[model samples]
Target: MIQNIVLGQIKRDPRSVAMANAYGTIADGYFAVGYNPAMLAYQQDKPFMLQLFGIDMGIGGNFISLQNLNSLSGDTIYAAGENPKNPHDDSKDRLFRQFDDAGGLAFRQDFHLPMPIINYSSGNMAFTSNLVWMSNLVFPIGILELLFYGNGRRPNMDMTFNVEVFGVNELGFTFAVPYDRFALGATVKYLQGLFYFGVDPDSSRANLVTSDYHLYGSGKYLFRFG
Candidate 1:
């Protein structure tokens, strides 16, 4: 048995992302709600801060990139006919070689939208609200090989994949109390689950086997939603 898990959260501020999350100690105002709320105490001189509108989004993948897309855009990786146009082309082989044996190719995306009129900060207390959405997908290398090279060379293949998506609305109240040498701060958050969808790995199975005289395969996928 083999299992893998990937976990991540989207950065809510561009400055945090640009600084590679090193801005936590210095974060102030409404931005400190998610990082170090204690830092909010240092913003006493700013009077008040209001966030009218803001959006953060990101998308990327291990096996997909601008360079790879440009290189494989017009190339035909596979054809069903007996005589194909590019019979000597190695594009299919090149694509198959990109994956390793350890794990599948993965892609992820996330979006964050701060509520406009509700996000505000004053004195040592602040209130904020946001909507967040996240998605992830994985394609097994075995499935890619089967798609690119067919069953002629590899008689057996595994067709397992993973996918997940979820969304949530968060409302938080933050407060900070400053002392002579330190500060105490905390954030109270209310989370409302908007939706969730994913494949049940424990209940899903798929495989394929081919031979000269016969071909056999089985597939069962269980999806869950909330």
Candidate 2:
């Protein structure tokens, strides 16, 4: 089963979740902080933009299911399908069979913490301070099988697991310059390296104990451009 911790929960912003930040109505106010800073240059003459604490989550995949769990929890579980008996014939069917119905997991999360210390607009000139963060995780079908059903029903061949997880935080200011029917915008940013962890282990015929996670590196810096 998939488990996670959920921060402050509240009514979600319909607009932010309804569509991607790239395409949507400006009337909705403050566009995506990462994409098209220039779009904010055309705000509807609002006095202030307040983007306090908010969280967004996206989960998708087709690996873990009632069938998979049932098989794993049975008194005397057996491989779903009999292992290819005898010398397998070499063909497209033989090679692709490994991933037929293995299973998978994917997820994305956004944690907002009173970002944009300051964000206000008037006329053509727009000024703002923005802070944003995001995290992504995915697990292929082969990895799931080795982790969940490797003991009960051992399969043929070996597999490697290289799962990755990291987060990025950007602190910066955005300004826009308008010209007749056109306008330009730029953002100066200070990037902070929060953390990064990795694990590289060959299943070695479905050994449960893998490898230890090692500390890598983390830092911060400043950069800006259009």
- Among the numbered candidates, top lDDT falls to 1
Q: Clashing residue pairs in candidate 2, if any?
A: 63-103, 63-104
Whole-model Cα lDDT of every candidate shown, in order: 0.75, 0.43
Worst 10 residues of 1 by lDDT: 1-10
Residue-level lDDT of model 2, residues 52-96, one tens digit each, is 444445443344456755754644322434336523333323323
How many backbone clashes are present in model 2? 2
lDDT of 1 by residue, 148-217 (tens): 7777988888777889999989888889999999998888878899999999989988878887899888
Give candidate 1's TM-score: 0.70
User: Cα deviation in Å at residue 150, candidate 1?
Assistant: 6.9
Candidate 2 matches the true fold with a TM-score of 0.49
**Candidate 2 Cα errors over 4 Å, as ranges:** 1-13, 19-29, 44-46, 60-159, 200-226
